[model samples]
Target: MKKETQIGYRVSAICGAVALAFAGLHAMPAQAHGKNDVKHVLLISFDGLHEQDVARCIGSNACPNLALLAKSGVTYTNAHTPHLSDSFPGLAALLTGGSPKSAGLFYDVSYDRTLYAPLDSTCTGAQGWNVVFDETTGIDAKGGGPLINLDGGGAFNPDAIPYAKVGGVCTPVYPHNYIKTNTVFEVVKEHIRGSRTAWADKHAWGYDWVNGPSGKGVDDLARTEINSIDPKTGTYYLDTYTHTEVFDNIHVQALINEIDGLDSTGKTSAAVPTVFGTNFQTLSVAQKSPVADNGGYLDADFTPGPQVAAAITYLDGALGRVVSELKQRNLYSSTLIIVTAKHGQSPTDHTKLVKNGDTLTKLLEASNYLDSSGNFGQNNTTTGNLNDGSGLSGTGFVQTDDVGLIWLRDQSQKDAVVKTLKANLGCTAPGICADGPQAYILHGERLEHWFGDPANGRTPDIIVQPNPGVIYTSSKSKDEEHGGNAPDDSHLGLVVSFPGLHHGGRTDDRYVYTTQVAPTILSALDLDPDLLHSVQVEGTRTLPGLGIEHEHSQDRD
Candidate 1:
């Protein structure tokens, strides 16, 4: 009845399907590794992390644990994620060795024609926004109603969204539905021998794939508590809590449990999962956690810089705990550890940006440029459609902190939209919008590079590039934000600490991108690069200081 209940039922069905599928696959005994064989890989993602933060921690001696890791490991200075580095897209590239081109993950919640409707089309007509489908609804689109329909059925509590009042519905598209390709974990499990895998994370983009022990490569893991669909009859349900809490409490606890099992079971010889990861709740801590950001009603802020620092310390402690456990069990030195982030955040001051003198906002309002709902770019007003090329009026527009995604008012209006934007918002006037390096009019090859399917859903006419100091926020604009292509959001940290590393203590400024993370991991594991489906994107070469000798003859390859 309730949407939450339906979500639970759907999650259970997926797990059931996974179990059935796994049962059909042949099972094999755990393989033992020869002496000196690397036994573990630990990958951790720090949400909203900048390269400077790592450097600051090292310089300030604030992160002693990470410092020790840096001293022993290789710290890559030029690692980066692709432009417009959002979490889902960034992680998609990290795990799949591809961009939106192959991964089909363009944004935090992108459109999927086969599995789910695009966000704008998924919702019921009156809801004003598109409906995001749930598993219970299935592909047929049955049993979906205003979110009230699900909450009314006693599925999930309606306290968060006021679905009863606004007729809102939240049908999350699961990871399997979102990702179109296999990840490095899946490849490793399928091809490698005598290896086990595990993962933990709060975000659906990364760890949800590892929910159960089947398709997800993790032999043991924790997913964002399963989405509950059935209040009383559902088979699976994550306790109602925020993702940050789940990551800090349940996900981290699950990792600890796995470590404890490995230690107590004396199962070092038992094929242990070679790859394991956990993404700490740094964003929530930095912007909202310990405080609810007015129950998700306020804009994001970097005001809690100290809280972010505290979270970093806490996560480092967790890292120490895991590493200590491994060492106590005599498995530490053999493991390869990596620390990085999905992307970084930008500093924005909504208070200053919203004043009448906020030239950019005034420009949009003067041009009769209405967002999705026929309203001019109003202050603190979100959830409007953009200038979509659809016949609908006011189809596309900008909202929040200056980030605009244009939905053409008609298919023919695309050119007009581009022309109007380049002329009106082209940074010429004091009141016009400012375009950053990340902001560009994608067409032809560039558009195709980011979206495999441009026909159904890729992006709108233009992606409003947030300036370096701006972020996209809901209420009160924001104090800080991401979703831009600034160096802060794109530049990331890459730390590789393992035996056989060149003690060269070298830091090369060579260009590297997130597309290289997967290949790097696979290469570290002594696996073939081709297996991960990586094509050596421009500037994506191997790490230089790994002590793994590369022949100059084959270097051209």
Candidate 2:
């Protein structure tokens, strides 16, 4: 048998469903992490954290814990997430060692022609559904209302799950099985005997992808609801930075509980996960909050306003708490803490934000690509409802934020649609603003080359990348948006901090992709990066300078 297959079979037998006891290594020693000495990989993602944000926060002393983390680790100044920086693919890259091409997660809300609609369970439908596994997939989404009950209404609702014919029977495709690649958690869990895996994030149902293919990768996934209604106020948990901080704190405490060798709720004692982390949304919420001076920089120089500054301060304090807990538990030296972002918000310069109403969709509708009432691609984060599919036009799917992603009812019309888009580059048509910024249309071979082919049933038939700072919505609530091809949208801050990583700290400016983090995590734990499907297929490598790679990104430990 092939070595990879053998390893998989062997580990699958060992890493069973039942929890196992971990050794008494807690009393081993408290020392700095050395090469090949990493036992725990703490991957922390500060969502919407930009490379410039880190540099400026450190220089300004606004983020002391972040500065210290950078001091003890190597910072990749030019690390970036996948193109068209949506959180689904962005986080997928960090944990799966793949891009949209290999990971097969185009966006959190995208179109798939091969899958039946959520309500279609008889193995029959038009064979296309707008895949929205966001907060709307939560149990509270039953009435098309706000996510009220916390804990994401007990995760994704059965009715909200998209079904398809697998083998010969129609079955629901969970987020864990939807993605094309295996994640670090899956590889680590299966490879390391008795080692636990855990994670915490903003979504309850939306983050199931972290579990990887087998759906058992994350032993403890804290389901903090980012969009649950604040019962006392009848507002979403994401309505204000203050509420967002509260939502983020629930997960932070969950991570602390995990470090304490307990479950995410601290109610049950469990083995500390071998691989674990959480993504913070305070910065993201701050950057996107529409309140005046609540987000974005004061200028192109990246000066933080009061709210952004406060958000960074909260993030630093949160990091400091984690560090202190690690030291208290003596896991500091044995843990490798990686700090980065799933994606970055755009238009760091608030002045550049251009908001308009549904121009791209209007253009497509006017061009006959979509019926007059047809709309597709419905992941609008600014909308009051979460995991919202109510706006789906039942004709086509076109999701827009800073970018326009279209999946046509008929894929053969892609060429003609592209022709119409090209003809209206200036968008002088009445459907679109004559004075609006021209967009770059990616269709046909070009779109397929970067992402996968549209024939895959998941890739958008066409993508529209407007000029930077142009958000597709005219909502007055947020200062920035993501999911675009802009520099600010993709660029992210990356810091790999171990106890004694580089002695005095170092910075690597090489263009590294977030996909490398997955392989690097495995390498740190003395596991094989090739165990990951994407790492092997995409040639993803470990971060440079770690002893995990003798030659950096090549040559195993």
For lDDT, the strongest prediction is 2
What are the per-residue Cα lDDT tens digits for candidate 1 across 156-268? 21111111122354344344534556677876676666666777554322334332223555554443322323234433222222334433654555555555555212344
lDDT of candidate 2 over 21-62, digit per residue (tens): 221321111113333557789999899899999999888888
Error of 2 at 41 (Å): 0.6
Off by over 4 Å in 1: 1-36, 112-174, 204-216, 219-221, 225-249, 262-271, 287-304, 348-411, 426-432, 435-445, 449-453, 534-540, 547-557
TM-score list, all predictions: 0.66, 0.88
RMSD of candidate 1 to the truth, in angstroms, is 13.9
lDDT of 1 at 444: 42
Per model, how many backbone clashes are there?
Answer: 41, 9
lDDT of 2: 0.77
